[model samples]
Structures are given as structure tokens and as C-alpha cells.
Target chain A: MTYCIGLRLNHGLVFMSDTRTSAGVDNFATSKKMFTWSVPGERMITLMTAGNLATTQAVISLLEERSKTLEERDPSILREGTMFQVARLVGATLREVIDETTNEGQLKQDQFSASIIVGGQIKGGKPTVFLVYPQGNFIEITQDTPFFQIGETKYGKPILVRAYDPDMSFADAIKLLLVSFDSTVKSNLSVGLPFDFQVYEADSFAMGTTRRIDENDKIYQAISEGWGDALKDAFQHLPSYKL
Target chain B: MTYCIGLRLNHGLVFMSDTRTSAGVDNFATSKKMFTWSVPGERMITLMTAGNLATTQAVISLLEERSKTLEERDPSILREGTMFQVARLVGATLREVIDETTNEGQLKQDQFSASIIVGGQIKGGKPTVFLVYPQGNFIEITQDTPFFQIGETKYGKPILVRAYDPDMSFADAIKLLLVSFDSTVKSNLSVGLPFDFQVYEADSFAMGTTRRIDENDKIYQAISEGWGDALKDAFQHLPSYKL
Candidate 1:
């Protein structure tokens, strides 16, 4: 019921996520799924969530409370030593929320499960990304597999698998993610526009450009319409079958 | 899992199905999911299956036996009065198979459920397609929705939505489908090469070109490689985002 992408390029990390959340086909709302915490020059941690809204919001609120309460016993994601540690704390928080929510109910634990994509840089550590599972485990992005996608991922994946380039500019990367997200939005009703995106430069350790693309954004419209025309054109260029 | 598509065009109907069937990620084998029954100059019917292999194979075998036996009480698909009747018969047969399979033990009925895409033309009937559900019901393809895909369909759907044209030539349709299937095969291990395809021309009342495209097929290879390049080129043509 969501589509989120955390892509690691050679230059930096690019994150995009749809804002639509639905309890049923007829009930829908726009909710922000991207969260960020930065310490000026010390660290920058960006997290994108997909799955149960309550679990994700709880995890975010817990992390926020821990970070804001200077004397809290719980570790703060803001103060984590590295991106991996931040991912671990987020995973633990997700698991803790799911555990708490399901303990008093007859519902299955998976009903409240959520996954997170946590990525950023610590002052001395290299920029990277991790996909945190609902089980409180996570996997880091690698050279061979440089991106992570969660929820309603398949429709947009073919283009990403073909067009992703490690050394592309932030502008081009955004274009690629938009094309990917556009495919998903067109095919699935559960994922919609007003997408949130953030760009993190590799060594900056500070949050890069953060913006939201809504339905009327000129660039989004152009890409959405242009990509369809371009795909038809590209399809035509392929050699015809001899039947 | 399987991936099959049935597309209706102005000229006629096109069907393509992957041969891969898997019990799990590690257990896979090739199996034919496309079946055809033709009464020359009278009718031409093609059916594609996706879901439980046992149920599908049972339905196909039952259809074959009933059609072959001269005095069988059960109606044969080849003897149907209209394409709609043929689809109804297939749906009933599918439901029959699933019911019989699930009645013997503790296995859930859903475990034996299957879906079918049946399309063809009979005398005095227009070419059409129908998606037959597991409940012995179906809906015909309309002008607005000219195609049906079952199982592992999302990865390959965006291109079909963008590139499909009812008025296009059979060669173009095949090319379009090959591009769609190539996207699927590249992205999913459950859907792979050796795709089986059948083309039925309007008013032919007989089978059209039927073939299997394996890994070495030059055209498949060309499309598989060319589409990646074409997509990359198409992505490049989209305007870069202003970040």
C-alpha cells in the first residue's frame, strides 16, 4: 500500500516516498512518511517508512522523544555513532512498537509490522543506506545492489533496474525516481503523488535538498506525460517481429 | 508462480505465457500454460492458466478428454456455441478442478485455486477475451480494458498500459508483448524465457502462428537487450529535475 525508494548513488543517497495511506480502497489520506534528524555538522539520518502507519508513526515518535529528552535513558537515533547504529535503533523501535501493539489484542503481530529505510552519514563514516526489516534486522546497500524499494515495488522496478547509474547527478537521479514513481502511480491506486524526496551528498553529513512534489508540479507533469510518449517511441524503435 | 497475458487487438487476440513454474525459489521447471482448441473454419479458442498447477492441468486434461470422447455427457470447449459460452465452460471446469482437489484433505481451497484467461472466436461471434476467476465467473474484456494478465503481472504492466494499441499490426503486438515479457523475465526469477505465444486473426476460425521463444531466439535476445538501451535512452530524454 506504499512505494518508497532509497537509492545510493556514487555521489550521494536519493530518497523518495509516496504520501498516500489507505485503510481500504475507499478510504485514503496523505501522510508524510519521510523523517529526518541532523546534528548540523555531526550526523544526518533520514528514514523512510512503508507498512503499518501506526507502527511507523510510533517508531518515529519514540525516536523523537528519546532525542528531544536530553536525559532519556533510551538511545537517540540523532546521537547514534553511525548509520548502521541508527538503522538498528529504528529497527528495534519498530519491533518494540509492534510488540506493544499486538500484546493486548487478538490480532496477529504482522498486522502492525513495518519496515524502514534508514540512510545518512556520520562525521567520519561514509554515506550509506540500510533496509530495516519488520523483524528488527537490516541489510545495507551494496555495490551490486545499490538501491532498496519497499511496498508496491514491482511496477516501478524494471526501469530502475535498467537505467540506474551510480555516477549520475542529483538532478538525473530525481528524474529517474520520478519516472519510477510515475510508473507505480499510474499502475496502482494505492500509491499517489505529492511525493517527498531528500538528497544527501556523500561527504557533507548535512541534509541536502528536501522537497515535496505535488500533483500540479510542472516538472512532474512533464516527466509523467513525456515518459509515456518516450516509452511508446522507444517501443517503436525495437525491431518488429517476423510473424 | 506464473505470468500470462491475453490481449485483444482490433485484428484479433494475442496470448503469451511464461513456461516457468516454481514450487519455491529453489524448485522450478518448465511447463506449458497455454492451450488451444480449434475446429477449423468454425472456432478457435486459446486458454492461458496461472495459479495452482494441479488445478490448471486437471482442467486442461478434463477439457481435452471431454473434447476427444465422442459420447461424453460433459460439454466440450470445442463444441461451445459462442466465445462467451466457451469462457463459461472453462470457468466451470476450473472451479470443478479446484473443488475436487480441495475436497480430499485439510488443504485450504485457496491452495488449489486457479485463474484462467480464455479468448477466441466462434462462428458468428466477434473476437473477444475473458478473465475467468476461481469462482466459476468471468468478465469479458471491454474496449477500455483490452488485456488480462495473471500472476506476477505488475512488473510488466506499465509498458503494456502505455504501448498497447488495438489497431496495431500483429508484428507490433508481438514486439510490444516481447518487451513486456522481457521486462518481467529480467525482474523476476519466477517468470522466465521459453515463452509460449499464440496469435489468432479475426475471422480465421483457426489457429494462427504459435511458437515458443527460448533463450537463444534472436528476436527475443534483440528485444531483451535493445529494450534496456531504449529505456535508458528514453530516460535520458526526460527533462532533468530542478533540484
Candidate 2:
């Protein structure tokens, strides 16, 4: 299992993903799920993968393998015209990998498949988030749906739905995501520490402030404990039910 | 889809459940998912159902039909000696209903199995809650596990995990539960009002406060609006992530 989220704010896009993957409860391992493909001043595309570990890694590796050509290949992500096009490229790669690896559709193959959140700024386009399905289709973020969450999303969703503001600062955006991820980590064993994160400021065309939040990051600790205490304090203030 | 929760506090028990049931997006109806049986000073039991509506309805109907005898008929719920025994009775009845309706297990039989949470005080015994599975097995709640949530539970779980206190007043317990339910209702259309709720104090051998909170209920409205504001306020007070 995995927990990943991407926020499309007025300032930029924020991405957060946990690194824990397990074949079963006993067989646990950590693998980075956040991948970045940037062309410096031109564009910076970020992706967070969830679902099948093998399929995600394979699709990402295939992209990296194709990306080394220096000149953008026929369907390379760097050569895409827009953020939507980049999502399409990633979706196609994911589909091809699953189709070649399994019989029937990947979703029906032992009921295992993968999904990705593709978000970034492409020179001429605005920063936005898109959730690409296993079937190679995608939907861009909208006002009503300002963010995209994949894998282990429900435990952390209420907070996002209530507090997300389109005009919030980049600092607030990442803090909001960390709170969401913290709730998920505490509730689910399959989602854990060393979360990879990055902020792609809109129009900057640069991947800025990338970091891995391990088990003992001081800021992460402060946010986790502070948020919990804040929730308790808030709960205390709510008017009690009329018995 | 339904969302029901039961909290086992040191002072008593609290039960809350949404009333909406939908077969498809187009077909929605309100059905009572919480039922109570009491022999006044002798005993009182509350049951909340979730899953296949038919299966749960059949199980509850069967238990009610047999309770009129005032004698422990074959496997009647009202005749159970302990809360654990009541859970076993409900589990076995649920299993019988499912087995009679399908070829395989309820879970595998068109995925129509039902689960239930049973809680109350049987005279001369301590108050407790038990969650009965579709397979006719059950487990009692304890100090480590202070609550049980069935059906669409994840969205409302983090709040419960972060703020639940066994020593809190009954007013606080139901307020906490209403906050949890409010979050679920806002995020999911499948789980909606009106909500049925009740509280049972330990050793009272009686049901305490009970109410059916509809969409226009004043307290429900206050809690719903108050919680959204409280959460946003809490989010603002959290330390921003230093990038």
C-alpha cells in the first residue's frame, strides 16, 4: 500500500509520498515513490506513484532509460507540449508496462494495478495536478477538486477537504500535506516514514525545496505533535451535544 | 453504503449511525440501521448494522421475531446472558441469513455480507461493545480497543484515534462522534442523514439519551458548522513547514 498527494495551489504544486511497500505484513521495504523530470528553465514535471511497486518502478525506469537520449524521444515526457500531455505520456508508459507484464488488464491481473499523480509547470502552462488512471486516462484538477490523492487516501481526506485553500502560501500547502500524510501513517502500517516531497512553484519552471522527511525530522515531529494537540484542543472547544 | 460507530467509554457507551442506503447512484432511501431491545430494569442492547441491506434487515428481523416469546428460543438475542453472547447470537443469525441466500460465503457471494456492532448492559454485568463478523465469529472491545466502527469507517477514523478519551463526559463522547460523522457526510454522498444515536451508561440496565438527528436539527447544524470552523482554525495555528 502507499499514500501520495499532490496539491495545486495558486503559488505552485506540492507533492508528498510515503516510501513503505509490503508484500505482506512481514515483508516490508522502503522505496522512493516520487520521481522528477526537469529541463531546468524550460519545465519541471513531478510524479508520485502508488499501487503495484513493480509496475511503478518499471514505468519510471523505462522513462529514465528513454530520457538519456539527450534529444527528447518520440514520446518522451520532456518533449510534451503541456502538463496534460505529460500525464498522457506517463499513462501510456504505465499501460504498456502492465499490458506486457500481465494477462488481461492489470487491474484484473490478481486485481493489482497502479495509479499516478502527475503535476508540474510546462513553460507555457499553469501549475496543475492530474490523476492518471490505470486505463491510461486522466483528469486535471479543477476548482471543486483542487487536489488529487491516490492510495490510502480516506484516513487523511477530511482534513484536506476542510482546510485546502487555493490561495494559501507554499509553506501552508506543504504543512497541510504533511498533516494529511501524518494521519495516514498513524492509521495504516503499510504507509510509513522517509516521505519524499518537492515544491514546484508555478511559472518558475524549477523543482524547488525537495527533501525526504525521515522518522526523526524535527519539523515533521513538530507538525505531527502540534497537529494532534491542536485537534484535541479544537475538539475540546466544540459545544457538547444536548443530552 | 453506511457509516456507523460505537464508542465504549469507562462511564458508558455511545452509538451513532447514518441512515442513508443506496443501491445505486440513482436509488437512495433512508432506513433505520440502529435498533434497541430492552427489558427495562433487566437489560438493554443496541445494535447497529452495515453492509448488504437485505442481509442486515433479515438478521435484525429474525432476532426481533424471536424475542416476543420472552423465553430463550433456539438462538434468540434477547435471551443472551452477556454482551459477548449477544454478539455471538447476532453473528450466527447473520451467517444463517447469508448462507440461506447465497451459494458461497457472504463476502464472496456477490460481496453482500453484513457486519454489526452490538453494545449494551445485560443485568449484573459490565457494559461492553462487540463487533460481529459475517462468519459467525465476534470479538469484545477492551481498554486497548475502545471503539468499533463499521462501514465506510476510514474517513472518520483519524479524528477518533486522535481525540478519543474514555473518561470524557457523555456530552463530549457524542460531540466527538458527531464530529466524526460530520466529516464523513461532507466527503461522501453515500453516507448521509438523518443520523440515529443513543448513549448507554454502564450498570444502568437502561438506555439513556436517544435521538434521530435530521438535516435541519439545530445541534447537528451547529456541530457541522462548528467543526469545519474549528478544523480550519486548528490548521491555521499549526507551525508552517520551514522550507
Candidate 3:
């Protein structure tokens, strides 16, 4: 299992994803789930994936190969004219991988399925985000729903629902994502550290700050421990039930 | 779907369950998920159900009927010698109902399955909580893990993990539960208004205060609204991330 989130904020787009993958409970490994493709000052495309590791890796590899070899028949995610077309390319790649894997075996189709979050800005389009489903369909983020999450999402959702502000700063957005990720990591073993994150500034058409946060990252530790204490204090401030 | 929690605290046992049940997203109705049986000054037991409504209703009906008719060969839940025994009887009854329902049709066995949280005390034993599985097996809550949640459990769990204290007052316990239930209600359509809760005082061998909290209840409204504000404030207090 994995936990990943994509936020569409007034400032731009914020993306974060956990790095843990497992074949079973006992076999775990750290694998980066966030990918970026950028043509400086022209376009920036970022994607975070969750679900079957093989399928996600395949999708990313296909996108990477297509971008490098411009002569290929398949469209490259980086060459797409708009964020919407990039999402379609990613979705089609995900579906193609799942179909190929499922057809080669007697196993269930869902066993090799994956979902993705694709968000960024192209030269002419507004910065945006989309949630690509395993069925190859997708939905873009709107003002009514400014965020998208995939895999192991429910544990961290309450805070996101309560605290998200579209006008929040990139620093605050990262803080929010860390708190959300901390909640998920503490509650479930399947989603662990180090986390990969990328920030994009709207209309800049270039990736902004990007980093990997591990267990020892000083700020991550401070927020993780501080959030727990803050939550307890917050609970104390609520009016107590009577009778 | 449903959301029910059985919490073991030093003062006694606390149980809360949402009332919404649905056959499909478009069809929903209110149904009580919490039940209690007590012989004053001798024993008290509270049970909460989650899963297939038919199976849970049948299990509760069987327990209610067996208790009323002493001539039945099956042991009455009210007559169980200890809380553990009561849990076993409830689990067996649940398994019995699910087995009966599945065998009568060609449907999958899991379609008739249900889970339960049973807690309380009989004269000779300590007050405890048990999470009863669909297979007629149950596990009791212990000091290390003093709570049990059934159905739609993830969204409301982080706060419980962070704020629960065994020595907290009953007033605080109810407040904590309201916070938990409110989170579920806001996030899920399958769990909603009019929550039923029962509290028991250890060694009293009788049910304590029990109430149904609806959408319009004053304190419920206060806590539900106040919690969102409190959480947002808490997020502000956390140290902001730097990029």
C-alpha cells in the first residue's frame, strides 16, 4: 500500500507521496513514487502513483522512454500541450500496463491495477491536478474539491478536510501534507517514510522546491511530535459532555 | 456501512455507534446498532453491530428471544457468567445467523457476515470490551489496546489514538467520542446523525447514562462545529515547513 496526495492551491500545486512498497507484510522496500519532467520556463509535469508497484514503474518508464526518444509513436507526457493531455497519456499508460500484465496470467485484473495523481502547468493552461483511476478515466480538481488522495487515504483525510485552505502558502501546504502524512504513517505500517514532495509555482512553468523527507528530517520530526501534542491540547479546549 | 466504537477506560466502558444503514448509496434508513441487557446490580452488557443489516438484526433478535425464553437450549446473553462468555455467545449467534442466511441462497458467505463490539461486566469479572469477528471468534481489549472499532473505522481513529487516556472522566470520554463520530459523519454518507451511546460504571452491574444524539442536539452541534475550528487552530500552531 501507498499514500499520496496532490493539492491544487492558489499559489500552485503541491504533491507528496510515501516511499514504502511491499510484496507482503514482511518484505518491505523504499521506492520513490513521485516523478517530475520539466522544460525550464516552458512546462512542468509531476506525477505520484499508488497501487501495484510494477504497474506504476512500468507507466513511469514508458513515459520516460517516450520523452527521450521523440521518434516513438506514443505521445510523451512532457510533450503534451496541456495538463489534461498529459493526464490522458498517463492514464492510458497505466491502463495499458495493467491490461498487459493481467492478460499474461490467470490472476485477477485488479491485482495489477494502479492509480495516479498528475498535476502541473503547461505554457498556456492554468495549473491544475487530476486523479487518474485504474479504469483509465480521470477527474480534474476543482474549487469545490481542491485536493486528491490515493491509497491508504482515510486515516489522514479528516485533517485535510478540516484544515485545507486554497490560499495557504507553499510552506503551510507542505506543513499540512506532513501532518497528514504523519497521521497515516503512525496509524498504518504499510505507509512509511521517507516521503517525496514537489511544489510548483503557478504560471512559472517550472518545478519549484522538491525534497525527500526521511525519519530524521528535523522539521518532519518536530511537526510529527508537535501535532500529537497540539491535538491533545485542542481536545482539552472543547466543551466537555454533561450527564 | 456503519461506525461503532467500544472504549475501555479506567472509570468504566464507553460505547458509541452511528445509526445510518444502507442497502445501496441511494437507499438509506436509520437503524439502532447498539443494544444492552442488564440484571441490575448483577450484570450489564452492551453490544454494537456493523455489517450486513440482516445478519446483525437476526443475531440481536436471537439473543433477545433466547433471553426472554429460559427454556431454550441456547444460552442467553443476559445469563452469561462473565463478559467473556457474553462475547462468545454473541459471536456464536452472529456466526449462526450468517451461516443460516448463506446456506439458504447461492450468494457469497461474506455477504451475510457482520462484526460486533460487546462490552460490560458480570459480577465475578472485570469490565472489558471484545471485538467479535464474523467467524465466531473474539478478542478482548487490553491495557495495550484499550479500544475496539467496527466498520468505517479509519477516518475517526487517529484522534482516538492521540487523545485517549484511560483515567479520563466520563464527560471527557463522551466528548472524545463525539469528536470521533462527527469526523465519520462528515466524511461518510453510510454513517450519520442520531448516534446511540451507552456508558457503564465498573462493578455497578447496571447501565449508566445512555442517549441518542441527533443532528440538532445542542452539545453535538457545538462539538461538531467547535472541533473543526479547534483543529484548524491546531494546524496553525504547528511549526511551518521551510523550503
* CA-lDDT, candidates in order: 0.90, 0.87, 0.89
**Best by DockQ, which number?**
1
Write one digit per residue (lDDT tens) for candidate 3, span A1-243: 999999999989999999999989999999999998899989998999999998999898888885456666453776789989998988888888888888655443478988999999999889999999987889999999999999999999989999999999999999999999999998899999999998999989888999999999998999999999998998898888787
Q: Rank by lDDT, descending?
A: 1, 3, 2
- On a 0 to 100 scale, what is the lDDT of residue B139 in model 3? 96
Least lDDT summed over 10 consecutive residues: which range in candidate 2 chain B?
B103-112
Question: Which pairs of residues collide in candidate 2?
Answer: none
DockQ per candidate, 2 decimals: 0.88, 0.79, 0.81
lDDT of 3: 0.89
Candidate 2 global TM-score: 0.95
Across residues A1-243, which tens digit of lDDT does each residue of candidate 1 receive?
899999999889999999999989998999999998888888888899999998899898888885455666454776778787888888888878888878665443367878889998998899999999887889999999999999899999999999999999999999999999999999999999899999999888789999999999999999999999999998888888788
Cα lDDT of model 1 by residue, B35-138, tens digit:
98888999999999999888899899888885456766454786779988888889888878887777665443387888999999999989999999998899
Worst 10 residues of 2 chain A by lDDT: A103-112
Question: What docking tier does model 2 reach?
Answer: medium
